[model samples]
Target: MAGSQGEGWRPARPAGWRRRMARLPLLMYRAGLGPLFGNRLLVLHHTGRVSGLDRTVVLEVVALDREVPAWTLASGFGPTADWYRNLKESPRTTIQVGSHRVPVTAHFLSAEEGGRIMARYAPRHPRVARRLCAFMGFEVDGSEDSFRRAGERIPFVRLVRSPAPGPAAG
Candidate 1:
């Protein structure tokens, strides 16, 4: 397994799959995964700081220690990536995994902490890692190296898990 501590990576997809994925349009590329993977894609809802309205986007989440925390990217693929920039401005967020929706806040990790998380969570796809590395501009050693450098361009949000609300004790 390519990982450490809370994060890790799975094996890479075959070349045939890569070609098929590359052929997909951006919107289709993002949506196709929903049906194919179902309940696996996480939907992130955030209020646009300027618009003051909610914007929703889908992201692939890396689940760390089950009950501990989850990690997601803001802009590792590109500094101009819109979804990531939005989250950076407004940390307040709602996350949907499967049918469950939970309210949480995003906290951007420092470069060092992000490197630590990346050491564990880097994915195996070289294409993906390469794209991330391009944005981060760091020397890549392996998936972990790419993951750590990916933080350079992308903001890392540590989901601030909140306690579930309950009935007030009378």
Candidate 2:
């Protein structure tokens, strides 16, 4: 895993059994193991744009917006990542976080917004933030500026949950 995390790596989409095996973690979370991850990780249930089939992926939550009740995500595999593309094709989806599931709508964030978010995140989660930058094929000196630069290069999305039915509506 460490070798694959190198900056030179630019892996294409997983094929054959690899793709099938990747869903195992997602399954674990959906099968009531979500509490182990807390809010840092989430399981996204989405539909493939071309295949029109439901898909699931476990992603790390880069940021959380309590006010808006949203989770911000980053594509470590770059902007053209399959799940990211799929969300763009169908913005409406569901996310499972810490034993809870909710309907969400995807909203792409600007590079500047990503920069600000990354800068703020670095101090709070220094080790994880650095690891994330490394995994994303970036190098950082553990500074907010360095993290911001790396963040600007990655694609981020804000997943805002849909409003629940009020008592009057029900």
Candidate 3:
């Protein structure tokens, strides 16, 4: 399940310095520097499935729908990523984008929907899309069809802002 793309497609877990570097963005978010990252990145706050403790992870925003106030994210490390798994176990969570925090509910997108998203994304961020696909061990030909196929192979989740809580009854 880890290597759906191919053997060695999934990246090994980072450790030591690499792990520290990966978590740097989280620190920035905590330090109120989230605005510096704009909307390109977001900090996800979720509860660990087994530990039942709060956890945080920074993920890239694959798509943003301001109208719905939703953000789409891809599990670059595949669905086995701890963050991705945690979300599956606890779909209710919160995300911080540019110093703005919003409660959200995770919604897993279907493969066909993911394909459409990838097709739309590639044209907008060709370089990032190509690099991301390569990093995920996908050989894309820089074609919409190729990107769509690659997107179908990966897991995508949309974090939609939860409705504001209504006033409590007396």
Top TM-score: which candidate number?
Answer: 3
- Tens digits of per-residue lDDT, candidate 3, 16-108, equal 999999999989988889999998999888887888778888999999999998999999888888889988988888888997778888999
Worst lDDT 10-window in candidate 1:
1-10
Q: What is the lDDT of every predicted structure here? A: 0.54, 0.80, 0.85
- Worst 10-residue lDDT window for candidate 3 reads 161-170
Per-residue lDDT over 1-170 for candidate 2, one digit per residue giving the tens place of the 0 to 100 score: 22345444654566899877866667778678888888988988888789888787899898998888999998877777888998888888888888877888889999999888889888998998887777676778887788899888778999998865211110
Displacement of residue 23 (Cα, Å) in model 3 is 1.4
Off by over 4 Å in 1: 1-40, 77-81, 123-127, 135-147, 150-153, 164-170
Clashes in candidate 2: how many? 0
Worst ten-residue run, lDDT, model 2? 161-170
- Candidate 3: the clashing residue pairs are none
Off by over 4 Å in 3: 1-9, 164-170
What lDDT tens digits, residue by residue, belong to model 1 across residues 1-170? 12332232222332796745634432442454445534335667776667766666666564333465464554444434555667678666676655456666677777777666666655644565555554344456665666666554345666665565211100
lDDT of 1 at 107: 74
Q: In angstroms, how far off is 95's CA in candidate 2? A: 0.8
